[model samples]
Target: MTPSEYEHEPIRGLPGDLPPGERILWQGGPEWRTFARSALHTRWVGLYFAAMAVLALLSGSMGGLLAAAASAAAVTGLLSLFAVLVARTTVYTITNRRVVLRVGVALQKCINLPLAVIGSAELRPLTGGHGDIVLVPNAVHRLGYAMLWPHARPLKIGRPQPMLRALPDAVNVAEVLARACGAIAPIAREDAPAIRPAALPAQGVAA
Candidate 1:
């Protein structure tokens, strides 16, 4: 995953230009440190390794202790690198018409959730104004949890919800989305149908 993968994009986060009357409201990627802690579970991983190291130390073997320390360092380093890649490659876009997740590590993919298809949004607040906003798609839209992975809500494979992970100033972003959705509430209630997977822009399997 590298920045060059997305350098060819016409717009910063979107796959293509927005149609007339549709405009971007807010755009941002995850804060890498917050992402590491929340999505990557770095703290839990470190604690697990620390427990292993302690157990190894209690066994009274110098080799075991060294091995545990090395394993912990290697895993932590890899996770840190992955978190950085996720942050760098991802760009969450909120437009007047939809919320777009520009995600992927090696093969970039875009998930577009039109406001009409969005049933509701939930915010999970975190420290320092960083948080996650999970979007619940209407029952008709079936997004694959595996495809969305870290960008999808954890353990929600049955009904995958696209998440804007570890976003900075997520409250403001959520409010913008609310207002945008509110603007079309009446029209959506009467005529908007969930977008089919085939209709999604730049849809592709991602890891």
Candidate 2:
């Protein structure tokens, strides 16, 4: 509970009154080891559960091999604790016009997206610098891929494109959201590296 404690506690993801100029250019979250190696691949499922726990310790005389090495160390510690609880309850915002998503671990809310219904955006980086920013809303924006899992866009069909997952630098936060959506869409990619949105760190998801 800190992104300045959702700033004032009304908590509908805090845009109850930001209309005079529409400020808030960026908020941040994710990067729990880049959402556990690109949205819970969890380092290739913990390297295939540590190579099946070293082949169940070389088949240790096999009697179900110590329960298959304790079930591959309990499924690699429950997928690294669900990617550190989805990077500590997730949150990604960028408000010059809109793009909020407070996401859920179980039942959390907030999922606005309005840069005039975002027709296109894509920035996938993912290696160590971490990245993802795939919003493609237009056609009356519906959204629902399990309501944006790990932010979403792994499978595409009709819609479901809201994403901002695992952003560390994320190409400078997608170049500060492509210079705030470049006056209503031209963010075709400008390669970000420097627009320090006040050095981020609104408390949480840093380690």
Candidate 3:
């Protein structure tokens, strides 16, 4: 039988039914190819192996060259497969009231970030209108980098920022999110290289 891990979700990518007034603004999953290239660093990995293979060839050892080539192919294949699995299992939901992420391969979990708790959003535009949206929660909420791997902003271990990675037509999605947040609260616009992000009011942490 075909596997159905999310069959139990009352609404796709959500842990439970939305409150009466809440409604989804947008819903999507990562574009797997883009996800592999960005999150898995597939291109970089392939280039490294290619460089090694070239160096091995220059050393005048056919065996070494073949070994390097094989290693590169094997590693790239594995990373690509891993990316596919992650992309397949992940779903991102943008509701009028919150952002929800359903992610994980072996073990799955849902992360809900209320609009009121989000401090700011940053858009990192990629080729072909695909991009990443990084969400920084306010002081009231704390999130772990490890727990949100591949879905967390890279090199942000100090303060993890939840990310919606490899989204197709990211600009449109960002606009949807901005509008949703803006409807509930005042939003400050921030300029980005490509699309702008909506910066919401910061919520204070309890003492």
Candidate 4:
């Protein structure tokens, strides 16, 4: 469904108040919410744990199996725990004025882009291995990052183009952004922007 068709609701966990002269245009959690059903990492982790559990149950060397399972379980548990922490800590906040992408557990890394400075937004979904949204700027900039997630749409405004990843409803987030920016329509793209191999930065880590 389009953002226009969906009702506007305050984010369940956020405060309702906004500073004077500022208004929230759009706010969303991770795209993982919507695409959880299809997340391969999640599936892989689940399968690993399930297999270990079954091995522990059926093996004659139950003690050894239990120890092995425990080690695997510890690692998997830590990975899942970190994922949840990252998802909870990361936030995408858009206002009439600018877009903010913040990531952190304690200390934070924030990338902000003003709507007025944006040339355009390109939405490209990754194909094959795992679906992802890649946002590119019309001009070269520092935020030329391609974010991977189950359901997210990359957005480009100005320098330091912030991307939202693993969101539940990324298309909805994009629609809300387009509405806030007063864009007539979303830009549809067949492929991600080609960049020089030397210029590409490190890919963002999956949550």
What would the per-residue lDDT of candidate 4 be over residues 1-207, giving only the tens digit for each residue?
A: 112211232442233444577677776555333233233365576677677777777776677677767876776666566566556665678786566665544444555556554455543333222222333444455653333222233232333444455555444555555555553113322333222122222232111
Q: Which tens-of-lDDT digit does each residue in 19-123 have in candidate 3?
A: 998888899989989999998999999999888889889999899899988998899899888888888889999987889999988788888888766767887
TM-score per candidate, chains pooled: 0.88, 0.38, 0.87, 0.51
lDDT score, candidate 3, position 111:
85
Evaluate all candidate structures by whole-model CA lDDT and list the values in order: 0.81, 0.67, 0.79, 0.48
TM-score between candidate 2 and the true structure: 0.38
Q: After superposition, how far is residue 156 of candidate 4 from its true place, in Å?
A: 15
Q: Residue 142, candidate 3: how far off, in angstroms?
A: 3.3
User: Candidate 1 vs candidate 3: which has greater TM-score?
Assistant: 1
Candidate no. 4 TM-score: 0.51
Write one digit per residue (lDDT tens) for candidate 1, span 57-115: 89897888888889889998999999999998999998878889999988788888888
Stretches of candidate 4 exceeding 4 Å from the true structure: 1-22, 31-40, 48-64, 116-134, 143-162, 182-207
Give candidate 3 misplaced runs (Cα > 4 Å). Answer: 1-7, 186-207
Q: Candidates 1 and 4: which is better by TM-score?
A: 1
Model 3 gets an lDDT of 0.79
Q: What is the lDDT, from 0 to 100, of the residue 198 in candidate 3?
A: 31
Please rank every candidate by lDDT, starting with the best: 1, 3, 2, 4
On lDDT, who's better, 1 or 3? Answer: 1
Which candidate has the top score in TM-score?
1
Off by over 4 Å in 1: 1-6, 190-207
Error of 1 at 100 (Å): 0.7
What ranking of all candidate models by TM-score puts the best one first?
Answer: 1, 3, 4, 2
